[model samples]
Target: MWQIAVVLFGVANAVQVDFRPYDHSAELLFNGSDFNHDHIFSRQELEQEFQKYDADGDGRVSRHEYTTYVTTSVPELHDFAHALYDDYDVSGDHHLDHHDYDMYYAKLDADSDGSVTRQEFVDYWVKLFQATEHLHGHGHSGHG
Candidate 1:
């Protein structure tokens, strides 16, 4: 079900003039998160990226902060920003903290090997976007 949304989201975005395919978005995220260029996303690197979303220097990330960052950094994801935020906010507290981060990281780390590979990261995000699209009822035009 979620996978359907992720793919639909990608297709929908592909139709827009400013559309950025889910794979591209995932690639950017993976590359950007790999600060050390090690081809692997370490927990530290992930946390660093998280901090970028933690605007205002607060220890936690509010829904607004996350949505702003996503829409600003990856406009194609704007429609699914809230869904993404809610997903990360596992505790349903309207904010993302260390616990949420840990859960998210675990989810991204599909192999449970403590680090995220480019493939793992990209696949996860693409699927997530597709799922969000389905959940949000973002109709796919199949035009692009």
Candidate 2:
């Protein structure tokens, strides 16, 4: 379902050439899903996005900088940014350098081989879907 679309979008977005397989349906495909710019960022795009958060052009994003980026760019996750920072900032230095970014992807590596292939990324989403599906409609009180 959504996982399939994510892999498709990931591959399409990763291509350097002008080929855009998902352009036609990108909105219809991802409008309601949590899949966003981050999910489809190519290796280059990921680096660019990291640089966006790396204020002062220091090549590293401090926790405060990342929190600010998330606050302005994706406010829905701002409250959780610190948790994400804790997860991605592996060195405990409260900053995310290139290696820390690599560690972020490695968390999704699935196989621990130091890289996150498309398949691994899609699998991770699928598993996350499965794990969260049961909680989707259970919290509502149905009073509205």
Candidate 3:
């Protein structure tokens, strides 16, 4: 009887485990950026979205501005903002401008297409978060 109970407990634990990665921040970002409610994220929409992070109307997003915006707007992602900012700051100039946005957009587009679908956006961000979490040995518990 004890062995049977132990087996049932193991099955319950297995059922509770989810290996799939989900990033709530990515979902929020996709919803916010899909301004036209068209399900697809176009480059124009992305450019407009990126502008919000500039904060100072400087046509560029500094590390401080980016961090502050993420912390305040997407608090759940605040922990990974630095990593995301670093990834987007391709030029290593500590500021994100059109060049960086363009490059990042291209990356998110995934298929060299001009637009990004919700799946592509979420998948990329989830992978990024997973990589960051692995590096830091911590997990983000935010759920969408």
**Candidates' RMSD to native:** 5.8, 11.4, 11.1
Off by over 4 Å in 1: 1-21, 72-78, 134-144
Per-prediction TM-score to the true structure, in the order listed: 0.72, 0.52, 0.70
- Those runs of model 2 whose alpha carbons end farther than 4 Å from true positions after fitting are 1-45, 112-114, 125-144
Alpha carbon lDDT of each predicted model = 0.71, 0.51, 0.67
Candidate 2: tens digits of C-alpha lDDT, residues 73-128: 33434434565567668778888888876766666677786545555555554444
Residue 110 error, candidate 2, Å: 1.9
Kindly list the per-residue Cα lDDT of model 3 for residues 1-144, writing each as its tens digit.
Answer: 001111111242221112233456567667877889999988888778778778899899999998887666334345457887888888899999888888888889888878899999988877875677643224423422
Candidate 2 accuracy as lDDT: 0.51
Which runs of model 3 end up more than 4 angstroms from their true locations?
Answer: 1-25, 73-79, 134-144
- The top-ranked prediction according to TM-score is 1
Give Cα distance to truth, residue 11, candidate 1, Å: 16
Worst 10 residues of 2 by lDDT: 1-10
